[model samples]
Target: MSAPGRRIDVCNGDADGLCAVVQWRQIDPAPAELVTGLKRDIELLRRVHARPGDDILVCDLSMQRNLPELLRLLDEGARVRYFDHHAAGEVPRHPGLRAHLDFSPSTCSSLLVDRFLGGRRRAWALVGAYGDNLSDVADALARGDGIDAHRRAQLRRLGEAVNYNAYGEDERDVLIPPAELYRVMVRHQDPLHMLQREHVIGRIDALRTADLDQALSLGPWREHARARIWRLPDAAWSRRVGGSLANLLAGQCPALAHAVLRDTAAGPLVASVRAPLRAPRGTHELCRRFGGAGRAGAGGIDALAPGDLAAFVEALEAGDWG
Candidate 1:
């Protein structure tokens, strides 16, 4: 009898992706090769070299971006399972592939896994949801579980810190690589327990605090009646704080759309765009026009030409966010 082929788990390095895989492994306790990268590294499906009959699990990546590679994997006779909440342009029908995908703005990959697992490890899912910036959804779920506000706050903090650590130009900008962080995360089933026992969570929180302090000193570069934009210099700290700053500004001024632009050395701008909390539509539409992709509430542009910044800001200011 031949040995079974290897099982490979590929996911995004952010908290939602990491937590989804964590829940699955904790439930099955199976051995699998983990494939992950920094938050900006979404083209992870191409990294796997699985043979026929191997098991491949993917989470939290856009199928639209990975369609060709995914087709290659399926054609190579590998059995694959995919879970995501991103914009998947087209889904192929194949007996070897099982996909659990939802693109709703209020849903995330972790929440999908939570539904699959019937909430067996709900706390972990909550952490993932929180990491994805689904605060109200995660909080409502936590409330149903009878968790107090204090513990809920801890979970939110832990989630934010975990998600925050995923940013950076490369692994060098982060305190620890995300795959290594996942190794530590899978050890604890409860997120709060991880916070209590692991020093890494505290370390992440401290670093996030320092990064935020630096970012808070900067004022908006462009402010209009309906939108605002902040520009950060080309630095590791700027890359690390761009997304978090967008979220912070969205929460602080829920009436105005916010854009956090990080000046990149590559002569383009990397941007994080958040629609107003009161009206979280049109952001995905906005980013897609700039060769970026995300959900309605939050989206990002990998690269925006310097000359196009004026037009992008104008679009935000004039958009009908409903």
Candidate 2:
């Protein structure tokens, strides 16, 4: 008798990705090998090694970035399930692949998972939506589910903290590794219960607050009628705060697109871009032109050269995000 193949779960390490996987695992509760990494580590599927008959589950990672590896896995005879809300260039047809992809700016991987599970784990889904900066969407869902104002607020905070923790150049820049955080998060069926019982969430939230305060104190490097850009020095705090800072700035100025660029020790800059909240679109298109990729509402560049800064700003100023 041959042994059964392994169950491998691959996802991005951000709040949306983690929460999506949490919802699935909570319902299934089967043992699986988790392959995840920091926020910038979008190409996580390359790490997966699946054999024939293996069951592979993917969430939140961009299909465009992982398509080659995914095709290889499918050819190896693995059965794969994928869920995401990213700009997938073209989805290939495969008998072994079951894809649930939505590129809508308002939806995210967690919400897609929620729809699949029929909202059996709705609270975790809310955490993911909030973390992805879909506050209005999350709020409405929570309210419809009869979740009170206070609980909704708590869920938002938890989502933000978990999402914030996924930033940073690497694990050392973060307060906790995302995989370890996932171990902490998956223990509780209700996220509110985890918030009440675990001190880790509070610790992460406190650090996020401090870092954000420091970032907010800095003035914008460039400001325009339609956009604002902030540049942060190469520092641990800056590395950890860039993505969350961009999200906050976008919320504060719904009419203006926001970009946060932080200097890295390796010479190139890391950038996080958010489309105007009033009209969220075209971010992925912009980033793709610069050799980066993301969904329409949010995108990032892993290592933007200094020489391209002027051109990037020019494109930002000229973009019709709507």
Q: Each candidate's lDDT (Cα)?
A: 0.90, 0.94
Candidate number with greatest TM-score: 2
Give the distance in Å from residue 6's predicted Cα in candidate 2 to where it truly belongs.
Answer: 1.5
Candidate 1 structure quality by residue, lDDT tens digits, 127-177: 998988889899999999999999999988988888898999999899889
List clashing residue pairs in candidate 2: none
- Estimate the TM-score of every prediction: 0.97, 0.99
Residue 65, model 1: lDDT of 82
Candidate 1 ranges with C-alpha deviation above 4 Å? none
Error of 1 at 76 (Å): 0.7
User: What would you estimate as the lDDT of candidate 2?
Assistant: 0.94
